[model samples]
Target: MESHIAFGYSFQAVGKGSCSTWGTGHFSTFDNYLYDFSGTCNYIFATVCDEITPDFNIQFRRGQNKKITRIIIELGPSVITVENVGIIGMRRMRTSSALKGPVKIVPPKADVGH
Candidate 1:
């Protein structure tokens, strides 16, 4: 089942076998909770809600692995807040240099009174 929240949406799977996938736009959020007993496959993908303006977040987790990956992509001059990523199996999670700030956006002009 999928649920929509104020800042974003959430998905929960609780059963012996179940799998699902979802996708959303920018300025949107996603929270997923899964409880699998008989082995299931789930996938999700989210993109910028607005074109030429990137502001989105992707959060996912797997019960067996207890792994969660949160990726935040912000565009058009803004600040992003990413936190609360717990330790993973004695190994600390770190961000690589490749992950940087927002990039410039150039929106196309629209024809008016044509």
Candidate 2:
């Protein structure tokens, strides 16, 4: 299992059907990248971080704990994962769902036709 430090909490992404969440603000979240049949092991959860910073990522990778079995079973042996595929930045997006947060909005000035 690899540990990641995001928001403030440290989490370890372990074996098959395992998961983790490490983030501070609204734009923070993680999505499953599994490609084959949807995970039959259905479960949902949420976690809160004590602090948040702009920079957060895989804290440190240890040799023995760096097994790739979980992700391999998730995406199948033949698939490849794209860069930043499962990470979410919802808080930074401009949409109705974003309207409920602390984000500030200034309506666009109407265009005056010549």
Candidate 3:
């Protein structure tokens, strides 16, 4: 199966742009700058790094075959890891005295019979 990401302006207040990557490492930046990068390395897709601790960070790793192997997302109090094989692993962030977690959300299953 192939994975494609479509971008949009969902959070109009927080952000106002779109960036997407699809098929063989083709990427379209937020400003509509398009490019192709087929590197097999860990890449920081997006992040707010000026603060002491960022609220969110999105990253992905490509395998030697030049395909995305996995994606790791750190969103506030949760960490989500998604593998290309369709398995998603999730966890929480440990605070000074407690832990903050996310509510479980599952993706829809693919219709393989089709």
Best by lDDT: 3
| Residue 106 accuracy (lDDT) in model 1 | 24
Q: For residues 2-27, write the lDDT of model 3, one tens digit per residue.
A: 22343211111123454556666777
Better of 2 and 3 by lDDT: 3
Clashing pairs in 2: none
Order of the predicted models by lDDT, top scorer first: 3, 1, 2
The runs of at least 3 residues in candidate 1 whose Cα sits more than 4 Å from the true structure, single-residue gaps closed, are 1-44, 49-64, 73-76, 79-81, 85-114
**Candidate 1 vs candidate 2: which has greater lDDT?**
1
lDDT of each: 0.32, 0.25, 0.55
**Tens digits of per-residue lDDT for model 2 on 1-114?**
444344322232333222342221111233554222222232222222332421112321112322111111111122222111132232222333211112111122324772
Model 2 TM-score relative to the real fold: 0.18
Candidate RMSDs in order = 13.6, 18.8, 13.9
**Candidate 1 local lDDT, 3-91, one digit each (tens):** 33333323222332222332233222234344332222232334345545444323333334332234332323443433334323234
Model 1 scores a C-alpha lDDT of: 0.32
- Model 2 alpha-carbon drift over 4 Å, by segment: 23-114
The runs of at least 3 residues in candidate 3 whose Cα sits more than 4 Å from the true structure, single-residue gaps closed, are 1-15, 86-88, 91-114
In angstroms, the error of model 1 at 16 is 30
Lowest summed lDDT window (length 10), candidate 2:
67-76
- TM-score per candidate: 0.24, 0.18, 0.60
